[model samples]
Target chain A: MNRRPTLWLLLSFALVLLLAFACQQFTGAEYFIDSSSCNGCGECIRICPNDAIYYNQSGKAEIDQTKCTHCANCVAICPNNAVY
Target chain B: MLACALQAQNAFTLRSDAQMVIAQSHTGVAGLNRMSWEHHFGPDLDLSVSSTLNSNDRIIPTNVQKLWHNGLVDINYRGTDFTVHADYRNTVFGASQLLGLYPTWDPLTSQKRLMQHQGTIAAEFDADFLQLGGFASGKILRYTPYTLDLDTFELVRQDNANATDVYTGAVIKVPIIKGLATHVAMDYKSGTFADNGEYDLNKLNAGLNADYKILGNASVSASFDWTKRTGAAISNGKTNLLRSTLRLRHRFSNSLAGYLLYINNSCLNDRMKNLRLMANYLRAQVQYSFPSDPTGGSYLLVGGKYSPENKADAYFVEGDYKVREKIYAGGSLNLQPDWQALISARLSYYYTPVNELHLQYSHRQYTPWNNSSLDFGANYLGVGTSFHW
Candidate 1:
């Protein structure tokens, strides 16, 4: 019987995990790439060992973290300017 | 990536909404998956492939090589008044240990390759809250090895066949109450398997789920799946499996969430062999969007899992950070206590069109009950891309 009560406690616990995904849907810290700030510095591309940093036709570098290895190479490489 | 960097020029219409990834494991397993393909040919075609590169003493001789492949295709259409889709995938892999090169273990002898193919196809339609689909899948396998024993190439396995499965299912979604929705689905399957050494099983499954949005950030739901499989070699004679899961989500604040989940599974066969074999896992994780003043979002997760069959229970803690929308990282540390403690880290690059290069490295040292230990490790590095044009 004591273990039965513990089930409610455990169920309440799992609900908490998914709340973050729902919460983000509301706070909506939307981010859009501002290609204007880019300075044509390939440093971001070079530092990203995983090749996550790339340049568009306009020579502006962008980072896609999903492909990023979080190796801090790009962060360490950008000299003039870099975001993400 | 270079193509994406070339934004202003003539470039492919890389579906920013598509998710594609290529992964490889040292065990000669490699995979490329495109969840939804927005093809240059059409907006409705999805393509994916998973393949393998095998070398070494695995199913071949010294320096001999084998290439395995997996592919997928999906066609989807959603007009203003109609919706229809079909998805198909096939996985083919080599599974064989290379026998010694020859009678004398010749180093220059030719190697052999063993392989198998598995495939599945599903077609569905969306009308109202009802969906109807049919699926067909199968596996064909072969294993043949040749040794250069003074130039004698011999056949290994005499019989290597396969199995096929065809299934049809119906799904219905209904709003039960104001804040609750119920999903019910049932599938009937016909399964067949060959190759005397392998296991063959047939089964049917039915699943139902209920989701209720209680308040804004909190909801509770329950789900169940039941499958009845024909006895097979690997089944230990088990014929049926039933699993049930209950979940509750609570978002107390922007930075914190409390989730509780419970799962119960049962397998029954001629007798109830693993009737006592049950699995229960409990975990609570934290999500933190890097402060706006900062750069990105990071999630810290810690959880516990208990499987009855394991020698004992184990505890795991993991943390992941997505700081730059361009940088991604996660690490896991686990403890089996008096038994072992291990840690692993993962780093990834983010690419638009949901495809990019990936590099991963992990190490684990196994501690024996006798206090002796062996170190095990795996590291993977590869590049993959998905393009619609």
Candidate 2:
């Protein structure tokens, strides 16, 4: 029988986190959100891990560009696609 | 941050893919380029940069190019209950360049289109069991070229409005018990419009999340959230929203599992003609996952929606399989209570040089919905890919 060593399991967790930030190299996909087309629905804000979308005094939702990781959750959730 | 340190020890991951399809006598070509660079500067500092470029061309209409860039330099300052960070970003959003090519398209010909605009910012902060941020940003919105519809007297440049909005907020998290947490956030924003108008808003939010482990492979989660928004602009508007969701999940074994979710949402949309909109939906699904395979999972989804004034019902069964490591495939059969059955599927590939190329093709029949009367029948095909780095 074969089983992974504990150290291997540790490395696996490390790799998953690496995949989170270091694996963005997939480019040229038709996957950008048009922010202007977005209605102030906050679904994407709730889906974000970074808590990046906020209100700009105009009462509309805004994304914290710095905190945004370009994950495209905003694009996927927007039925009107104001985010791309 | 740990990720940056790990990836820094490796280098040279290059990937790219392109595809072209001609269907329904319509030709389209699309491609993707994605890359990332992560580096660690010291014990407390790390940086990561990511970018994506997407462009598509429709033979007669629907041509578009969307480009985005994001980067962050995180300063990890260890704290008792929070980690502090600082990030900066620059983004350019433009869709006019593509819409400009399709002059004869009725939907866009007389409508508003996005020209070009940029959003830029830099911020620094500190935290402990709580987070707060303050940043400066500038935005520009350009009107799309438009033609007036004289008969309708509708002056539409698509949506000719642009503005720069500035705001900041903070989040506070509190744990009530094991596997339970509560959070509260507040935000304030100001917007300046190009049409000689402005808006200001203040909002308050609170939410709670809880999870219970029923067994080794089963769990239940529930959440409730409420928000209050008051806007002082064009017309004074005040609204409130309450949303909640509950889900139960279980895995029968290493290859099968299921879940059921219930959602309730209520809102007062001042723009909904003063009618409070309430929507409720229930979704349930069961799946058989293919073991020893990272790409195959089959599921049956049944769900329905109910609004204050109408109802909708649907059911679907779908299967996901990785015919090849680089190739992924899935499809579904859907049935509506008042419409024809819908069928859909796709085959997609994840390409690599030393590995086989991935490809996906899917066709789906869509059913339309009407609160007054349900009538439906539509179909579409989508083929796309994601390259690795």
Against the native complex, each candidate's DockQ, computed on alpha carbons, is 0.02, 0.03
Off by over 4 Å in 2: A1-84, B1-17, B23-25, B37-48, B59-80, B84-162, B194-198, B233-238, B268-275, B285-287, B294-356, B364-389
Q: Where does candidate 1 stray beyond 4 Å? A: A1-84, B1-70, B79-85, B88-95, B98-113, B126-129, B145-208, B225-240, B255-258, B267-277, B281-284, B292-298, B310-330, B334-342, B345-361, B367-389
Best candidate, lDDT: 2
lDDT of 2 by residue, B111-187 (tens): 23343233334333334344444344444434454655778866445445443555556656676555566788776
Per-candidate TM-score against the hidden true structure: 0.52, 0.55
Q: Local error of candidate 1 at B337, Å?
A: 7.4
Docking class of 2: incorrect
Candidate 1's displacement at residue B169, Å, is 4.8
